[model samples]
Target: MATIRCCTCGSPKENGKDKKNRIEMRKKTKGKTPRRISLRASLRASVRDLLHMKSKPAFVNVSFKTDSSRHRFIQEEIAKYGKGNITSRIFTYSELCEATKNFALQNLIGEGGFGRVYKGYIHDLHQVVAVKQLDRNGFQGNREFLVEVLMLSLLHHPNLVNLVGYCAEGQQRLLVYEYMANGSLEDHLLDLPPQKTALDWTIRMKIAEGAARGLEYLHETANPPVIYRDFKASNILLDENFQPKLSDFGLAKLGPTGDQTHVLTRVMGTYGYCAPEYAATGHLTVKSDVYSFGVVLLEIITGRRVLDMTRLSEEQNLIRWAQPLFRDKSRFHLMADPKLEGKYPTKALYQALAVAAMFLPICL
Candidate 1:
């Protein structure tokens, strides 16, 4: 058997020292009993904590410019609704341009419906950051920029990406976030490069739990609750350690409050992730986000895209393709990602699938 070793995640600097640090870490944790945290139980704890949590002032140390009309209205909306307060610095357009080397083509890390994201170094902050430059041609994209800035300014959590600063200077609508080294979950989980290693079953389960904690913070811990209208593989960023943090708040909306049951808004979100009720009637509840999470969980499990035109028409929709297998416990193994090569535990796979089924909008 090979020698046992431990490695630090999300920290490239620590990778070289894994062997040396192993004994120290084990010594530190040797006397303590390790507790296993389950997805369902962690959610229950989030609710209980919310019930007992006392009101507190803004905990984030924020400093920013506030002169433009946008500043007057675009400050993080979660804080406005009294969810929590988070703050960030304001970056000049020139600074961002300089950081990204005039938006070099090589530094581009990601691009999506909202805009192109580039990796940049901010000298003032003394850190690398992911800069999202909103697509100027998109009119609705402009509104998305406003919603994201306001949402991040106030909401802070380990599972939620940190907003370092923003560039709402003139026609430039850019958001600066702490650099996530490993890139989005979609990068590692979806397409497989022949040389790249596939994610192990345990890592997939761990990512699912972390993503849930982030959603739990938004829905249960936030004062008014936040609906993450767009929850998908691309939006869930990862660090060097493979930890998941929910990013891209451009589509976020505050959930219902007081006697209201749900917030009614135009149906919006990724094609396969939108809840049925939301798509049919535009009634969005926390359940909408749940459905999206379920889709992601399934993606993580089966290594399949939520919607794929390349697959056969019958198998194009991931949920529809898996529903039959979900009914019978014996067929659950059939739904596991082929890439896993059967390395995962059978019991844990069943538990993870059960969580996914529970969050999906329909019964298994």
Candidate 2:
């Protein structure tokens, strides 16, 4: 080895090379520092932008005139309802959207003529809720919304589905209800998928009794009496324990009062479930609901759809098919759900069939 120099003291040539290397390293770092800073800033900015987008409001109104006035009117009307036992909160449009995960398709649990219902988890309340958002394109409108709000807010019954809250912001109209884990009775009875189990006779009878009680409450207990023009299997929602609750008050109308035989209005209900008189003439009454209740009861007992095209042309309509059977006490056994496999008591079957027959429209 050549003569060893002090570690701190380098040869001139070595010093020159070391200095050059240090400068190059500094230059490289200096060049990349701004890029690194920009990248971090860019990431922060991106995050901010994403948050801003999510924070954007739904159904925003540039002119608040109409909305404010209408909102005031709604609040006034609701106030007139005297709160009663209705403790539904008025939720913001944004709150509902967030609760429903912006109304994601995957969150949708059910849909019908009224609108689509979404299953939502409300973080603030720490509860799951059913959010029913009315379809703008559907037959339902503000009138139906108001009817539902008024009817449900004023009426409280064990058999009635609970109204948790409502959202009436801008053009958006939504109703929030307690979640029914078991879904609708129609889901269990008709058009059932292979995976779904048929409802047992005991559950079916329970559902029928609960649904009848719901109708009875509307027709008798409610002030001015209410005619549930839209009563059917689909409107009967079931909880985890298979307890039934009446839902969808959109088509509900006040029953006739003081010697009035019926309330005359535009007829609106599911085709097969509508009472013949109500369908022919827009005359509605508690009896109309009774007729509908009968149809649903018949469906429960027979395990047939209200309108099944699969049957022979003459036997397609459940009411027409059952009418003849209702006349002969011996034929009542034939009306029992085949799924029951004759497991139910014959006496119980006769009594249930008699009740259903009592509800049928007497054809002159």
Candidate 3:
């Protein structure tokens, strides 16, 4: 028989090795303790799991944070993205639906290649806005929506349309923008009947200059630079004062970051307004905008759509028909819209025509 010694009591044991092994086992058992977790680590893990489960595509409509830390975080993030003062608001889909009456056809202002735009009043802001509901069915719509959000969120210019806020609820994607009272330049230029008050030369010139400055700002002022992919008359909106603001940034792209002079992209623009080089090779440069601007200037000068299928066979395409008339100042009168009727400054018109002519060959 073995007499055991308790390790703690230091009692004698006949089987010393067995007693020692028993003591060691007891010590090992005593050393074992329950694992503990940090509150923050546990919380983070839980949040990650929740986010994984809610994997649907959505936009974060961030509520304006009153907390100093949260506010500072937002400010820092906006600064990192090189954006100016942006008033943050998180509008619920229910609230917006109520405001626009569930995006009824009655609320719709216009429809374009991108999506349908609706007019809505944001009660908090106390202003009306144009809500562009992106079509989720098309890949192009999603691509354009992302591009617009990325570019517009960081951009702020007087001549550029203001992006008030955006919505991303499940498959629903919408962009809120400042509403233009007068609609697009194309609307006034082409859609209005002959009896309506046509755009005067002064207003037209101002529109041209304003549009140019907007494009120039995108090219020269914007960080990393941007090229307005679609620079047609329809994209130019007029305020109550008839001041032009460049809207519809869906096709906008960042300029080349490297030594490359141009960005190579798939051809994406209205048929007749796209630069000839870009249309042919998908190589887009700042000059592409200049080419489009020239086309618009031609339209303004001639009061002709870039492509008018209704016109005579010889004069159906504006650029092709008008390019030859550019050299003959005598033909400048022929190109001028009958509505102007010698109302514009001859020298100013002539100079503008000369500039448009110069761009034509390059664009062609």
Tens-place lDDT digits, model 3, residues 1-364 = 0111111112242477876897787678652523211112222222223223223211212333454433234324333322332343435567678768899999999986567889999987898988888775643454465456555655667788988877655556678888999989998887468688889887887788788878877776554457888899999999999889998877776665446677777788898888889999988888888888888988888889999998899898998888677756687788888877778777677766776766667332
Q: Which residue pairs show collisions in model 1?
A: 10-241, 75-150, 76-150, 77-150, 86-153, 86-154
Residue 195, model 2: lDDT of 82
- Global lDDT scores for all candidate models: 0.74, 0.73, 0.69
Question: What ranges in model 3 sit over 4 Å off?
Answer: 1-90, 138-140, 362-364
Sort by TM-score, best first. Answer: 1, 2, 3
Each candidate's TM vs. the true structure?
0.77, 0.77, 0.74
lDDT of 2 by residue, 216-300 (tens): 7776555456777888998999999999999998777656655677767777889999889888988777888888888998899
Residue 143, candidate 3: Cα error in Å is 2.1
lDDT of 3 at 235: 92
Q: Please report how far candidate 2 places residue 237 from its true position, in Å.
A: 0.4
Instruction: Give the per-residue lDDT digits (tens) of candidate 1, residues 105-203.
Output: 999998866779999999866899999888877533545665566667667788899999887666678899999999988988897898988898878
After TM-score superposition, what is the CA distance of residue 41 in candidate 2 from its true location, in Å?
A: 63
Predictions ranked by lDDT, top down? 1, 2, 3
Cand. 3 TM to true fold: 0.74
For candidate 2, the TM-score is 0.77
Query: Deviation in angstroms for 180 in model 1?
Result: 0.5
